[model samples]
Target: MSFKEASKQRGLYLATVARNLRLSPHFVRLTVQGEDLERLPRHGYDQWFRLCLPTGDGPVDLNALPDQFGLAGYLKFKSSGLAQRVAVRNYTVRQHRPEVGEVDIDFVAHGDRGVAGPWAQRAQVGDQLALIDQGRGFSPAGESDFQLLVGDESAQPAILGILRDLPRAAQGLALIEVPEAADAQPVEAPEGFEVRWIDRSQSPARPGQAALAELRGLSLPDPPAVSAYLAGEQALVTGGRRHLVAAGWPKSKIEFVGYWRAGGAT
Candidate 1:
């Protein structure tokens, strides 16, 4: 949890799937709606939450969610046999339209191997879901000369959201890796901000490999200060940070996060 604990705007919100759309062969967009979402705080950049969904064909009581937020609260609920019937996962808030009381979540559908991916693949409009707001991770103090963003598939939504919120005068570079070329989408960015999309459609390497390889080969600007945001597989985040530091970037300027592990990609 790279998120700030004190910054969490905790709340148990009930959301029903309003629609599901496939953005690519590996991306599914789910629109969830509820009046409770109207009250959800907008932290913008990399805002995420913990989702509670029905698990393993078992009956679930949406109201059975833990009364508290954080690890202890989740563990308490899990100890009571709720873990079997409840599926928990953390997801980024891709879009939040408070006026419509709707939040859009983009899921990386890798296949039927994982709980969340399968659920998103076949989710219906009326399917019920629960979530606890955990707030965001990207909070810069506006001191950097430029920014650097790098991530694999899982971090796409977060990186995209960050790009959306950046000022028009911002200058930076964003490297986003996807499983296939079809997964790449047009992203809005400042004129000086280079958004590079790395396609690993023919690579035998796993997710995050392409991004890491690209970062190693990239030539960064000679700026006074740079803010780097690295996310996705553990290796990618750590490896990317190491590469940056070796290239003269300050350790304090980089925000590295392992959003998921390669072993769990299936």
Candidate 2:
């Protein structure tokens, strides 16, 4: 399309669900498809997406989605709007393969309490999702002497993405504080990098908890520059970012994302 048309594009694209995958006992994968993915961005650790799915009855329908007041489309969709509108959840863009117009998002399943979690638990072929326009990347830019990535399942997808994109010679350390050993998934990283999974499945990840404490005690090598990216619960992000800054990582170099706030909207 012309640059004008592309530049005018607003809001996220509406992508239909192609399939679902149960990555592990605790997580699910929603594979979505759309033509908008043709010129998708190659965002590493910084990418995020909103996961919107049907909340009501049988075969999913796109015309039924809530959209701006357009009488014609409304008549077409509402008449057959058999699905109930539910909540919209945010998830990381784990992998986007534009070659096939498909993208994969990993969801942590915690039962019906979470809308997307349980929905994905029973997602079928041809399911529909109103995917919003893509979000900006989360990967650290420029050169860094050393970097750090930390989070739980909430951060795994982005963590894995970051690790996958890191140069094979890149140097860094990953302290993936996850729920138990089962939550620890195999990740690809540089030879000099070390990955440590802190098991805490028995309880929710608390603020200034075990992982943060451990991180504080460790000594890091000083270099020309260092950066860190953190995503997960709010308190952790706040404290983790503060600690890293105090530890010498330039605040500007740290990208801490509070994926979800505790007891409030994500």
Residue 56 error, candidate 2, Å: 4.3
The TM-score between candidate 2 and the true structure equals 0.78
How much lDDT does each candidate structure score?
0.84, 0.67
Worst 10 residues of 1 by lDDT: 1-10
The TM-score measured for candidate 1 stands at 0.92
Instruction: Report how far off residue 127 is in candidate 2 (Å).
Output: 1.5
TM for every model, in the order presented, reads 0.92, 0.78
